[model samples]
Target: MFDSSKRQIGFAPPSIDNECIAAVERVLRSGWITSGPELKAFENDLETYLKSPRVLCFSSWTTACELALRWFGVGPGDDVLIPAMTYAATANIVLHCGARPVMVDIDPIERVVTLEKLQAAWTPQTKAVMPVDLGGWPVDYKAIGNWLNSAPIRERFQATSAVQETFGRPLFISDAAHSFGAHIENMPVGTQADITGFSFHAVKNLTTAEGGALSFSLPSSLDLEQTTAWFRSMSLHGQSKSALEKTQSGTWQYDVVEAGYKCNMTDIQAAIGRSQLRNYPDHLNRRKEIAAQYTKALETVPWCTLPVLKDATRESAYHLFSIRINRFQSAQRDALMARLKEDGIATNVHFIPLPLLSLHRNRGEHMRHYPESEACFNEQLSLPIHLHLDDEDVTWIVERLCYHVGELMTPHA
Candidate 1:
């Protein structure tokens, strides 16, 4: 157990300050709330922050992904390729769109979808590739973009939606729920993929308490405003006018365009998101600092393996510090976690690979089929990485972790 001086840590927590509280309070006090001035302002600020063609806010990452797929016209008889090692939301969104999600395995180290895997999984029925930025590290979309544009791959592409038809190619959708502040190819995530979705769940670096975003840079053939009009209508049960617009005197008349889902973000949540966005640069920097401290302390511990934060082209958002224990099985990982918990240090596993879950298993996506993904899942553990951790907390957490892991490696009588 940790010394009495330390407190029990949490794996992920929102960095809520007085300013964040004030932001949300302002929404509550305002007469206009749901998708009102605050949501609009947040979207506008995000537009400038991300420099995207557009940004659409949603209630959750699941809805943002599902809505984006639906917008791209992914439906029955189509296949969307996704990584086997992502949260179920990535594949679940594909299932919701009536498209079969082809479970593609990840590269051994990056634990992200690679062009080689995509090539193996490509089928004539494949209409989109939804590569998740697994844990905050952005995937290499430039290479994937090249592959999708190549004759060998593009020749088989079938346009499923109006947007797909306009592009004349398969969609490059990114399930980037963990990569809110990451960058790839000198571009933010919003520009890297044709469509990128972000999560602002409580555990995320940038939290809305609970919300998501859809940011994109579609081809010129796609009219950004026209598509956004459709998305605005679709997000709010196909309303022709937003709630705020309806508030204008003698302007209540509206129309339902597509029997859409009610997944629009509320002004209250947007207020929180805006506050987080304002602080994101610093929030992200602190996370980087914590990750660096962990690396410095653990790099010499042969049993400890730090996460990869950057490569030649991609840089992680530093959302999760998922360290792997060399040669440790799931049991050892769990034992170590229990030890950490006893020591007042909280930890978590980034994900249980989708293939191993009951839903995927029922769909015939068994873990045995994804040996590489299984290998990754068995050895990973995520430590706390957020604004809440101070210099002392990071040092204490790492010191306890290294000690516990070392003891586990010791020979027993």
Candidate 2:
């Protein structure tokens, strides 16, 4: 019988304390609370943390990245290569731009798209390569950058806009929504890609309540200040000056440059993010400790395949602890999730690859086309890893997980 008095472990809950509450309260008490000083301070903190040249905050990762695609002129007749194993938002943004998202298969173990897979999917219509850092593990940014800049890849370039022409090759925009603190080649994830977008969603490792930011790493030839201004304008309906700027005594007059999207991060949200950022290092360390605990406890299990936390060149953000049960089918995986839930433990899947979604299926994308992604999705299960969980919670969760998995894997009569 399941114990009703036991605590139910959540999948990923935001770590909010008095600091976060006080920060939000301070913002609420301030006279100016929109996109203003707080947001700028938060962006500066991120810029320093990631050691990137520039960073822009937005309402959500979806908005920030979609804006990036638009900036690159990824319109109809263009193809953006992405992995089939990522969330629907990855593909949805491409479709929203009226471009096609050419899905690529992932390495079953790494669960990330490789440069070789991307090379195979390239075409003249390929305008951008937006590979995701699945589960906060970075893709091979160095190799992919080299491949994209190679003579063969560059010679086949098709520039549709001034920004595209300036690059003389396809843009390497990384969907780094899960890799905010992750690193590769002694550099942060944001510095590797031409433009990397990080999610600060409530369920993410860091929460802005609901926000995101983009880190830019374009070539030296472009005017980065102008580029930054343009993105800031676009986020605020293309106004020549921000509402904060317009508040000045005689600076009310401003012009709209172009029709743009309204997705700027609010000062209130930035306050929460700033508070979180202050103690983010400790939060991240705690997550890593929990992941280590889970790995050490479960590695001895015969059927369990633990996730890769670190390698020679890359390290994850410890966003999720996804384990693969060898030979587990989708139905069995679902059953195991249910069994864990019955014990008041919440387990989840990282994603149901784009091919399995109805939106992609209607476009003629088949699950059979991505065998590796299909296999990974079937066996993959994301275990809870959050600040809310302590060592005792991790041990209990692991015990329940192994018990339920063992029961489900037993031979049936």
Which structure among the candidates has the greatest TM-score? 2
lDDT of 2 by residue, 232-256 (tens): 9999999999999999999999999
What lDDT would each prediction earn against the true structure? 0.86, 0.92
User: What's model 2's TM-score?
Assistant: 0.98
Cα-based lDDT at residue 37, candidate 2? 97
Error of 1 at 10 (Å): 1.0
* Candidate 2 RMSD computed on C-alpha atoms after optimal superposition onto the true structure: 1.5
Model 1 stretches with alpha carbons more than 4 Å out: 1-5
Top model number, lDDT: 2
| Model 2, backbone clash pairs (residues 3+ apart or across chains), number | 0
